[model samples]
Each structure stands twice: as C-alpha cells, then as structure tokens.
Target: MQNTDAKVIDVALKYGYQSVDAFSVAFKRMHGIPPAEAKKQGLKLTFYCRLHFALKIEGVDRMDYTIIEREPFTVVGIRRTTPYGGGTWAIVKSNGNNVTAEKFFGRFYDLGLCFGFGQDGSNDYMCAVEYDGETIEGFDSFTYPAAKWMKFEAKGSVTENVLGSVWQRINNEFLPQSKYKKSDLPTIEKYVSWDEAADICNVEIWIPAILK
Candidate 1:
C-alpha cells in the first residue's frame, strides 16, 4: 500500500463524526472500499488530493497504494429490452435484465449500476449492459478508449440519495473548484460485492479526467 492513500475514518472521527455509515461512504468513494475490507483485500489506494480546498480535511484517512496505469477493455451485453428511464430504477432494471445472456455465460457482469447518455437533464436515453469480456446473445461488444482516469471506491445502497449526492458533489463542487476538468468518458459503477453494500461493498467509479 502506498502512503498516498490514507484511511479516511481517522479524519471523520477527529471531526466528531459518529456515523460509520456516512464516513464509510465518504471513505469508499475516495479509496474504493471500507477500511475493514480494504485491509482484508490488501488493495492499495492512491489519488491526487488538494487540501487547501478542503477536498480532504486534517485527520482525514486514506488508503496506502500507488497510482498505477490500467489498460482499457471491451464489454458486450444486451441493450435494454424495455423503455427504461435514466434514473435508479432504469439503470438497475436494465442491468439486471437476465434473459438468455446469463444462462449462456454463467453470469454476465454482476448487476452493475449504469447511467445513460442524454442531451441535458433527461432520462430519454439508451441504457447499456456491461460484459466482462464474455459474449452473450443479442449482445454486441463495445470498446471504451484507454486514458488516465480518476477512480474512487465507494459502498452503500445504489439509491438515488447516495449516488445522486455524490454526482452533485463531483459536478457542482469538486470539478469546478479543482484544476482538473471532467472528460467525456461515460461514468460507471462496478460493484464487487452487491450484498454487503451497506457495510462493506467494493464500488469503483471511473471517470476520465484531465488536469488543466
């Protein structure tokens, strides 16, 4: 584990925080897993942090890991079979649509959460299914370009409250104040443990971002 990513709980507790739930969400969003699970999996965490902006406060904990580069891969999965909205309901429904794809390939990617592209703030967009490099019926493979990405780990319910709040913070607070700019790469959520999301879930959010 690199010293760059430190545990976040320490800071939260220092600031008189009592709710592990909230602290866990903030920690995972920054590190990619709960403090307990991160220790269990021995996953290193690393990312650039700006302290002047309070992007992180003192006593704020982080994971210890190096920021390593990763190559891009192609994923293929079924398109939406129904008129799915672009909200939590739509994303979850389209991802979990187990038609013939699951049986043929054991299990396509776990019911990962997804968001569709839109012109503005509209839900009338096309949702997608993710493939873990495995082929399935009615699924076409699409490749996302490889680029330096800003990744964060998070856990908890895929509820609109949690995710929506995070998105709002990133778009409204974080990006605008930081020297980095948001890229066009689509947002994604990869859940390593769906069942234990509340307590300990492995959530990785990747966004293509470049420094100004």
Candidate 2:
C-alpha cells in the first residue's frame, strides 16, 4: 500500500473529494482509520479495482444475467441528488413520517419496478417507477432511451447487502472477464422487494454494455 501524503491527496482528488479532510472522513469510516494514520501504520487495504471482462472461472458465486433490448420508456417518482456513496438512501427515508416514508418507498420496491440512474455520482439518484408521459406533482419524470442491457438477478438477505455485494462482483469480477464493456449510460437497479422487516428479498442490477 502506498501511504504517501501526496498519493493520498491524489486519490482524494481523483474520487471527486473537495479536500483531504473530506476524503479522510470517508476513508476512516470505511477503513477504520484516518488516511494519515493508515499510511503511518502501513496497513493493507483492499481495493475495488476496475473490471475487464475476459474468459475465466474466478468468482465462486454464480452471476446470472441476460441481454435484452428495450424500447424507450419513462418513469415518475421522487428524486434526490445524493453524493453517490453512503447515505444516499437517507433522502428517501426522510420523505414522510418513519412508517409512512418506509411504506412509501417500500411500495415501489414491492412493485419490482423501481429504477435508478446516475451511478457515476455525477447526477442525482432518482427512485421512480414506470409512468405515463404526463407530469405529476411532487415527482420528476425521466425517459430511458432504448438500449441493450445486461440484467443480473440475486435473492438473499437484505441485511447482508446482497445487492451491493453482487454488484461489486459483477463490476470487478464479471465485467473484467466477459467479452463486453460498459457503456457511458446510467445503470439500473430493479428491486424485487424492499421489505425492511424481511430477512430476505430479491434484487437485480442492470448494466448498459456493448460487445468489445
């Protein structure tokens, strides 16, 4: 691990952080220590490296997905401009009273039609469902262009962050080994269930890709 202060600053800037202090706070939350302390201690850190799809059997977990071309569609729902990492869901949770807000978001997840864009952290995170092209109050509408997509599905305990874990595997493990490359488009997250009280549920992550 390169623990140089210069390297720390470089990484902070590369990740869109405004300052070392901001990056250090996020780093400490993730790695349990300040960046300076981490460097001083020379601790080993795991990195989620960029994936390049190739032919090989590596990940033990099975990743099942299918390629499908869909026509343009529009969705309407509440949207929040989050900073693209942790606490992104706080906005959704803060909408209504505790139970009401939970149910409001849960309804969308239960319908298995919720969609998200802006995974790149450069845009707002929109939580919405397919809707007519009509304007709706208190909600924003977005149109998804027609394109090819790879949809991976997983079912497991929500407490385990199943969706997030599988997404990491797909991006870091599967994409790097496959014959396809990601496209410059927003990825989609299709929730099969959003039962906060449930032990398990289903979810899907969709990535826009093209054959390399």
Candidate 3:
C-alpha cells in the first residue's frame, strides 16, 4: 500500500492541481470523503482512469456540424472569472441580474452568445452578445478575430447541463480522433431558443480549429 499523504500529493501534481487543499476539495466532491480521511479510515477509494478516444466503425455516430469562417466580431456583456469545477456557472446563473445574454442584448435573434476563455475551467466565462460597434455601459467587451469554426448544432430538450455534456463529447471523443487541431481562440456557445417554456430548442457550439 502506498503512503496516503504521498499518494495524494503525487496525484495532485499529476493532475496539475495548484495545492493539496485544492486537490482535497475536488477529491472530496468526487469521492465523498477527504483524501486524508479516507486514508486514515482505510476506506476504499475509487480511481478514474484517463480515457482514450479511438476511431472505430462501430463507434462512429452521426455528429451534425458545419465548418464556416466567421468575420471578426465584438461581444459586450458581463464577464466572470471563476475556478474550474467550483460551481461558478451555478453562481453566475443564479445571479441572473448580472449574467444574461437575452436581457442585455434584446431578443432580436435566436442566438445568445457565450464565450469561454481558459483551459481546465479556470478562466473567464462571458455571457454576451454581438455588439454592432456600440458600447454598453457597465459591460465588458471582447473582440474576436476571424477564424474557421466547427459549429455543432444541438436541438430538442436542451438545457444548460445538456449543452455541457455535448461540449465534453466534442472535446474528448470528436476532436481527439478527428483530423483537426484546436486553435487558440475562445469557444462559443450560442443559444437559439425563443420560447422559454418550450421543451425543444436549438443551440450551437462553435469551436475554432485548423485542419491538421
């Protein structure tokens, strides 16, 4: 058996955790007990191994997407910087007065804009809309450069959590095995729902990429 503290530290470093405290918080959230406590109590611990994406005929599923080159555009809205996996989205969404795309930009189009900039979820999340070169008071603005994007459409019974799952699949399963590399640009989530109470709606996720 490995030493508990040593094992925790090693795992933390391997996973790019800043400190043991941060690692412990995430560990407890996932495993239902602190690492040290689990070690001391001699409780069984579950380990999640890394997943590898493979291109197989059986694994192939129809993923609807289209490639398009978009021109430079500016987005204006509220921005929040939060730690990865720290319930940042929950906090932002709960405080709907500050973070809202439709309210700020007005319901002109079905597409509501969101931009995520950062790796490992430790980054700025912006709920914004395309600005027509007009300034909005008390809002942050980000100008995106022209680039080729792979846009994936999600429709029917869409929710915030469901969109997140789609993003995970795109990153882990689709992108890894595809003939494309992610570019150094922010990912976009466009909400295309006009009816708030509707069971089905359309949404699009755009990821910047270059052919490899």
Which scores better on lDDT, 1 or 2? Answer: 2
Write model 1 residue lDDT over 7-105, tens digit each, in one string. 555655766768767877776787777755653333566434344435646322332322224467665543343343445434435566544445655
Sorting all predicted structures by lDDT, with the top scorer first, yields: 3, 2, 1
- Model 2: ten consecutive residues of lowest lDDT: 108-117
| lDDT measured at residue 73 in model 2 versus the true structure, 0 to 100 | 80
Tens digit per residue, CA lDDT, model 2, 1-212: 13234677888899899998999889887666677665442243334434435796444445555666778887666555555442335555565423442454444422122234455654456666666545845666677788777777768888888877887888777787676777766666777676669778787777777787
lDDT of 3 by residue, 1-212 (tens): 12334677778888899998999899888667787666442244443323436663333444655566788888776566767532434554576733355566664323233345357666566666678856877777788888878788666664455666667778777787666677877677777762447656667888887877
Off by over 4 Å in 2: 1-58, 84-88, 97-123
Which candidate number would show the highest lDDT if scored against the true structure? Answer: 3
Candidate with more favorable, higher lDDT: 1 or 3: 3
Q: What C-alpha lDDT values do all the predictions have?
A: 0.51, 0.62, 0.64
TM-score of each: 0.52, 0.59, 0.57
Q: Which scores better on TM-score, 1 or 2?
A: 2
Ranking by TM-score: 2, 3, 1
